[model samples]
Target chain A: MIRADETESTIVPRIEVGERLEAGFEWFEDTFDSAINWVGSTVAYISDGLAEILAIPDALILTVILAAIAWLVRNWKLALGTVGLMLFIITVDQWNEALETLALVAVAAAIALIIAIPLGVLAAKSQIASRIIRPVMDLMQTMPALVWLIPALAMFSLGMTAGIFATLIFALPPGVRFTELAIRQVDAEVVEAGHAFGSTPAQILFRVQLPLAAKTIMAGVNQVIMLALSMAVFAGFVGAGGLGTEVVRAISQLNLALGFDAGLSVVMLAIYLDRVTAGIGGGEGVLAKLLRRRKSAPVQTEETAEDKAATGSPTT
Target chain B: MTDTASNNVAPAVSVQNAYKAFGRRPQTIVKRLKEGATRDELKSQGMAAVIDASFDVAPGEIFVVMGLSGSGKSTLIRTLNGIQPPTDGTVKIFGQDITNVSPRQLRSIRREKIAMVFQHFALMPHRTVGQNAAYALEVRGISRSDREKKAEEALNMVGLAGYGGSFPHELSGGMRQRVGLARALAAETDLMLMDEAFSALDPLIRKEMQDQLLELQQQLGKTIVFITHDLNEAMRLGNRIAMMRDGRIVQIGTTEQILNDPANDYVAQFIQEVDRTRVLTAGEIMEPPVAVLGAGQGPRAAHRLMREHQTSALCVVDQTRHLQGVVYEDDVAAAVAAGAEGLTGLLRQMPATLPGTLLAELIGAASQHAAGLAVVDDHGRLHGVIPRVTLLNALADTSAEGAVRTILEEAPA
Candidate 1:
């Protein structure tokens, strides 16, 4: 065996890839500064509006409304968890920051989905689009969440707007990938059946493919929401105020108790959002299933409740 | 032939020189670009699913296309409706050339003229039986209430009444197939293309469905192109059967004609395993009665007739050739010894059979009657007779010699 030193085995780089990437970012920041600011401000407007709306009512009243929504959308267990988590954040004096984080996630996820789903459908429908979008998606996913903030801070100044812009970009790849996959996964025989029945191509897409792919698309939405929530702390580095700012403040001051409270509140909020979206994706939500049942107007099977929890995902 | 000659109208479906090959274009191009590639080399790059398939179906006829798996029968059916477009051919449906029509025109033709039934009951898993049946009507822009009404009628016709509210998964395999049938029936098109529609069913259910389809066809008189791999089914339902082998139709004729004169060794080997009992009717196997003694003749004439014909029994028929009874040689001898003047003293009631009775059905009658089973016309006149030896020969013969014997026996005497 030969012993080797870390510096002795290395060779000098000719291309300097990292420097070139930094230069590329600087060029993009200089060239598209106004366009980036406009997008950031638009995202900021939606996020601020959502935050103001969520923060208006008393903490108690807000908790009651959220618990009611959880009950209607999910079940009794999720409703109780929502009520408990909201009260815990309020008791720890982190209610305002928690709502801010929630609003940021909601706006970022909404925009990401709005853009990603159409691109994904385009990719699924055409081979050229699919070949082009795949490698771009891989790059978006493989890059670090914090790396997105650098460009955001360069183009849009330090604030919640920049934070939201970065978080939206960081959490977009899953939406596109899963949407394309869901559309591609539809059974070919079902599509052929549609054609055999004399359906137009557009009719086949709307009636057959979209309805069948709905559950998987909802799963993709759940992924987008979860990713946005996870990226909040990274967004805090650029002065995006929320629970993340509190954690940063606590850490700088070496206040363990404060840091613990803020971190625990973030975890609680993440769980609440995660479970609600997952329930929706799995078709376990009472409201969606009830609506579907009403349209068909058949005798309801007892296995529906069980089927809802069992499908859409196998990992759980 | 004369019945068909009187009608100068066009055929219901005519496929001319149809060819379908399966593979991507780039692969064939790459193979063609190779050095010193021969014609066979380029041919090997793509699979020929159907090669120059051509056939004509008369109006209101059950034209069965029969083949083993991979023989391109399904592909041939798909080409009739433009589901799988032929590489080079013209398919005319009700005198309209499908290749010359626009996609919109073809779609309208499919909606108005042709309906198809699938093998695996290609029903929407999410829809109810009635909603699945109404799918074609929904595509045609019919109102929901009207679609439901027509779907209910179709379901009732298929003996699935009151099943409108049931989902497809809630039904058995046979019932799901009936829903598929009901879907096709609801369209009420001039032509129906059934691609192994009953092949997925259990044997008993398949038999019942075949009978139901036959009865419905008799009443509806719709021109149907039925494709199946089962020789028995082809024989049972087809007005004219086309035997396909390796993507080509080897022979096209009635069941009896095909059995008697196969076009080639492929068709001969294809039908070698077919059960003759199911495929042969009494009319195909029944022989002319050996001796017939008129009712006005005496027992001496009956005995003399039996002796001359070298048979033990003679049929007693009226002056109009309507059968009255059978008299054995022993009975005739006894009557002759008693000095009987007429054949009525020696006459015994005959065991009669319809000309359309299956040979399988006649086996029990032939064994029980001891003399023979007499094939009778509707007017009670004896057409032919199936002796014990003939029934045994039909059940025992596996060689093509049996076909030759049938032809010889069926010839005018």
Candidate 2:
């Protein structure tokens, strides 16, 4: 008997999926040449501007500012850790490159969120939209991340613009998926209550659904930022400058020291962004606790004074 | 029973042959239902939540839709507010047809004419109790200060005055439901829909909430459609209750009528465990006074009337039937022996109750006197009398069959 694999290969005609994809890419480039060029130049300008702004502050002062934010949002331990990691990057002369990577990741993630959130909301509200979007999102996520660079390179050529475009696509699915999940997970009775009170669809979305889904949506935002950071490093393969360039160069040349230093800098940056974003998402950061205490302080004092007055004497 | 067409005054809510089915093809299911298909026969096609329900709620009347889970009472209430428009038939609120209205008009009608209290409290977790209470008014585009003022007043009405600043998570379950009630009340709508509003609370809290709702109803006089699975709650709060089973309304009647004359086995079975003593009123069981003595009648006449009626005592009343006092036969005989002229000398004070007093409360008063309790109107006119034996029979007639038999055997023609 013939083997099952051999029989399958002989019976089915091989489809030229790879060739079709290449032709599709070429057609898109030819059709949207001007639009692609405009987007590329705009993204490049914004990334360059952000890099220059991030570079203006002295490295030490910038590190201090970041550490201070970590302390306020997180804790002293995280702040100290951030200071150590950032200082090591500065010592290794990777601070400027790290800032550039930061700029690239920031721009890509912001744009991804701007597109994904509304799509997610639409998907959550309408069954047809959800059905259509879910399969597309699945395809986007499951497709090899590197495959996106091929079309991105053809459309924008080489540079940070191409890097950002690839990174944007790579980071998009989670934002959409998580947002849809968050909104859909809101209690049905709560939504019914909104409708019962005569709230319009828009009002219910903004006032009831969004507020209740805030923490979950913020978790989606954290995932987007993390994905953007990882993809920005991958974008370095297509001439996107920053720590990614160093990493690519070190990898090609097989220089162990350069590779190790660049890789560590990327790790430090990822940890900082992840922790800060997680604190914002989880809602029990040190700063929040302090603020809540401060808000309740006056009420406690007023209550005590009222109690004394009500008892026919003001002891204090 | 429905006065939608017959009455000159428009009902607060009028539902006509409303049918709601849940599935991809609700219309097909509704059509099948109309063609005489039973709910079980069409079960695979769609779940018929409500089938051909029709009712009219008069203004200021508490119309209760009561059923067990999966009986479509909740679905029926939703049709009134246009939250879930029925698959077939029309719904009107104060004479305006809502079934065919646009979304904007439906929302406007909800904002202007209707407010709703939910089962699970449904208070927003992110908002403070005050903000939750103000939600309905905020949706109506009321000014912040005005809505806040109204919300505070509503909270005060629900006895949650100082808890407004607290978040819903900080409040107890009962308090959260109070905030839910305050939210509906602050809307100031003429019509309110409550879907099992007290079902989630503890027994004690549920009873308190029910009493508060009744008190609020007395003050506000809002037309309310209350949905509940608990028959006792329906009897306690509803002016008229519609009993539902398997997506169909089985019967609609007052508590007395339903208890004495159930339309079907389902309603009888449904109300099997209802505490009849709590549900029935003294007026329902009271009989016309056997032999009423005029205040101008002498003690001898009272004694003679008591003997003629075979009663131990006679109620002395004015010419206009205003209850003066009860004259016992022994006292009348004593007065007669002492040569007293008027019943005034022999008349003794008797406990009087309003017609609406529940028999549970009258049992104690009924037990205290040989003459039993007097059922009186607001102006102290004697409507009827509940003798001790009648009170005991009414209390013992807890089962629906026994109640019907007792009413038939004992009720005067």
Candidate 3:
């Protein structure tokens, strides 16, 4: 069997005909090289420095953390499952590393949401704006995610910033596209209803359209979070850290156990977030149903309360 | 919202030659556009949904617009509230031309002075009942406290009290409709426009809502522009009814005038479906008694009364001048079987109609009440019989010339 060094040689492409032609491939080389340097620096900085996260919306932040615990482990059986999973991950002694991985994911998702929502609302409002923006959204959506990191590294230099930049691009399309589509799906009757109430376009957008489209928008958020998390792990190739780093690190050392544990942790986090998001999305569904029934709830409430609590996303 | 904008010369509400259209084909509108079609012209070629229509709505009156489906009733009503704009005309509310009002001004107008109720009840699915009801108030910047109070009051008014926290999906169709009405009522607007609002409800529920609307109207005296196709509903609710067809008003008049005296064939035919007897009251048709007959007289004796008075049937009365059974010729025959006194068996009589009863119901009740003849009334007492001939003659006098009594009364073959 080939040694680790020999494997690296096989994976890396060989030099071609001339320096100029080589330079023709220079973009890739430069991108990778910078990405390596960027990751190295970010690791160096994070190892020795603190990562500063801007203030989390207190309501959403606490709610999310509480939701993670409640949704996955609210019951004793679920609690045991979660505890077992956590012990398995920590026993591999990648807990600190997993925390770093989670941070990167959280950052990417937050950035994607920040960028996508405004763009979605803008697309919903103006045909001209949509015309200018839609083609770019198409490109972002169609292009493979890894391909973006090359440019991201070229532009931002290889580090947490570049890694996040790449992850953002990868996760962004779903949220923005879904948001625009969902907003468009808002009932024309609803729009008319808002108008009848004397709602201005701005008011209708904020009060009527967005809230009505909440579940759809939240679904978009789910896709974005999942995609960002997936992309963040892959980004470790450019020296972006987290469970992905451990995967690559273990692969480098030919340590299958470490690689397996890291991959397992990522899957766990993914499952947790997916459940929470899905739960919240389901919660909004309940909210909509409950809203419809509010008039008669006085008579029927005993029958519906349990359903509401189960489906209601206190976190959302 | 600029609802606070002053209008010194506003004419309440006015529509001038308004037209609304949609393209039958995409290219048609584009072709028109190329052919120098302006916004109005471009819009006109499309579906011409509402056509060159003009009407004025006075303040504090219930004005009903009646039409069959696709007759521009909904479109016209929607345009009044600024949800849809007219293609080639002006809509002025309280003197300001809203045809080109900025979205801000339009919102303000809708917020402060105009409210609309939709047939589907378009309540926001995401909001709780209180939240939905208070939506407009919030849009207009009302504080939470005041808005909640107003929403509560509105919900109570619509019979949705204590349901402020529930979501729409939890409500039934009727409850949802009430929530919608509550939402509009919460807006505190002066002008209320409804588009087939009660049509989606069941018959009994619809009747209840209609009664509620009347009560609300009576209490508030708000100016209302209501759209409906059911002639009965229009008659019941409208102070004035505008009959529309193919995008134009065919006729407009008071319920009494429209029912008793239709303006044209279209209006008359429209009236034909209505229970005309219900529309006209005894007070309106009452004139001096044309003839008199004794109590318990039969239609057989009505020949003398008809000949004496030269009238079809005598208005029968009892001893105390109260209405009693009509003394008609048929009653006379009946009395003969009962051993009538002398040559005239007039004591066995009956008249068509009772006091204070809807004459429209009389025909159907006639058989149940048993007697081809009818009884009239002075008050609650039995009047006299309108004999088969006299009744036919009276109807003949009132019916239009050559307008045969359409065997409108028939079970389908």
Candidate 4:
């Protein structure tokens, strides 16, 4: 009887595969440890910078971010909860590390959006490019995000670079997929109208498609930020430092309070960003107007090709 | 319509053998590449969206392209602005071949001399109404103040004066459409492409807008290529109508020529549901006036006058000769039989609401009541009676055109 290992041996022969897997894991673990430490340190610096710029106490930073978000979302209750979460993180005396984690997540998410949106647009407009890049995106989205650490460690050799690279891969898919989908899903009638006005392809894209897709692309950005937060915590396994590094340190030392505080801070930051961005996407509608638009805009269209390639959009 | 429009010279648009296609043919691109092919072969794969469509839009005339959905009116319209290029033939705007022109030239032509109003309006959701309207001028890189001024002027022209600051969602459908018109006008074009622009509006609003557009065209003297599926709208708006089917122009002619002397069964079917006289103006059939009666003429006097003229009715008038109700002989005879002597006649006594009354309503009202009904005024004074022959003739003419209209009216649109 043929075993699954026999089938795999044909693909990659001549090596003791189990040994190779162990060796790869060892390499990943070593790189992961140092990457987490570096990321943690960078996070600390960013947090300090944010506190100074905003003129808030380092401990109050998360609370302020969440409170601002809640205000924007018009959810005073949620805003108060964000304040409570911030105060809780401060009680654990990990406020500085928490601010660092927030900054890392913010920068990673921004970089992801900047790269992904343009790529997504390019994918939408070109059939050849879309066909080539779609399978790669599928693999990125489907493979366990831990796989990113393997490649990231090999290339970056452990530090903030490895942490950022890993966070970018995990958080990047939504931005590309959503931006592509939004642009492609622009109303055909509107596009034709643009054409009839003698708008060049670029003009139609930037003026008509992008503006229409703003909400969708923003949704992608929101997902990237959330995913980046999740990945940032996991980056604790690497040497790159952040609150993730503190959590790792606490786990190693068996300090439950520190680990729990770090974890909850991450959740608070995620909630704050998610709510704020979502409120923006929801638009400046009266409750009645929101209900009407929500009921109607979705009937507008569900997906574009960008979503189809990245699979971030369920409709695609 | 064509002759009058073109006699002045320099047609606004002319399409000669234009064709468009989508998708590939029998051989796929990969297969062709393996077999070693060229660009022209790859282009032939697409299905023809528009095929050999030829027509000229004369200056200051409303040229309507009428078709059922997917008849390539859309593709044809897009070609005028150089959005979609024809596989063969040339599209000339003011005798310049727009098909092979540079992208910059196309954009310039669109900015300066051509504007389009789409079916869905296409007003930007993110922008305010003024912003959407000013977008064309902005694309031409106009000054902010200059563009705003142009947009404001256009808004007032389209009757959307204060809607400038509002977003598209804030405006009603009619108001949004007005914004669309303003956007087109802001382009300051000599030709306007209206692709079913009014089809989405409510019926009353559609009529009002159509009338407003006609009034605008008359005043502005701009050429228009209007595409629609509604035959009634075509009849109402088109100076010269081009009926398309399956990406081909089936017939092209004036409304009267298409109706009265239908080129084919399709053209005949189109006007079959129309009230013939309504499609016609009073100017079409008016003859030189010959008084059938003198100043002292009574009902009896009008009767002899009509007989001599071989007409059943004669329009009554004062010494100033203002139009009054038409007097019918039978109405006079009936009033005489009723002992209401020295009175109005049949057509005079019967009520008339001008020649524009609906055929159905007139038929229903005059169905069996033939007492030579008094054609009264707001004061209920007799003017003239409606001769049965005149009503019958009008009905026959309308029902003939109305055959298509009845078929459409019963449709599931």
Please name the candidate that would achieve the greatest TM-score relative to the true structure.
2
Model 3 / residue A259 / CA error / Å:
2.9
Q: Per-residue error at A179 for model 4, in Å? A: 0.7
Estimate, for each residue in A152-269, the C-alpha lDDT of model 3 and write its tens digit. 6665565566677788888998888888998999998878888888777788888888888888998999999999889888788777777878888988999988888899988876
**What is the Å distance of residue A3 in model 1 from its true position?**
29
The sequence of per-residue lDDT tens digits that candidate 1 reaches over residues A1-316 is 4233223335833555767889998898778878877777787788889999999999999999988878877898899999999989999999999999899888889989998898888888999999999998898888987888887787777888877888888789899988899889988766666777788878777777777787899889999998988888678888888988888899899999999999999999988888888887776677766754522323344343223212211110
Please provide, for model 1 over B196-246, each residue's C-alpha lDDT reduced to its tens digit, 9 standing for 90 to 100.
999999999998898889878988888999999999899888878888876
The per-model DockQ list reads 0.20, 0.33, 0.29, 0.18
Which tens-of-lDDT digit does each residue in B1-413 have in candidate 3? Answer: 11111323344678887776666664455445446555455554565566667777776667889999978888888778777777667888867788898778877788888888888888888777778888888888897777777887797798876677677888888888899888888888888898898989998898789879988987987778889998888877776788888666777777767766677777778777776554443333334454666555545455666677665335566577565543444555465577655434343344355433444655554444333444444455543443344333333324466666457677577
TM-score of chain B of each: 0.80, 0.90, 0.66, 0.73
For model 1, report DockQ.
0.20
CA RMSD, predictions in order = 7.4, 5.5, 10.1, 10.5
| Per-model lDDT | 0.81, 0.86, 0.70, 0.71
Chain A structural similarity (TM-score) per candidate? Answer: 0.86, 0.88, 0.69, 0.71
Q: Record all residue pairs in model 1 with backbone atoms less than 3 Å apart, i.e. clashing.
A: none
Which regions of candidate 1 fall more than 4 Å away from where they truly are?
A: A1-13, A16-38, A294-316, B1-9, B26-44, B281-358, B370-413
Better of 1 and 2 by DockQ: 2
**lDDT tens digits, residues B1-413, model 2?**
32223566678888899999999899999999999999999888889999999988888888889999999999999999988899999999999999998999999998888999999988898776667888898899997667767887787799876565667888889989999999999999999999999999999999899989988998999999999999999988888889999999999888877887789878777667888888777777889886899988898787778777788888888999999989887888889899988766677888999977788888777777899888899899998998898888776645534435445777788
Interface RMSD for candidate 3 relative to the native interface: 6.3
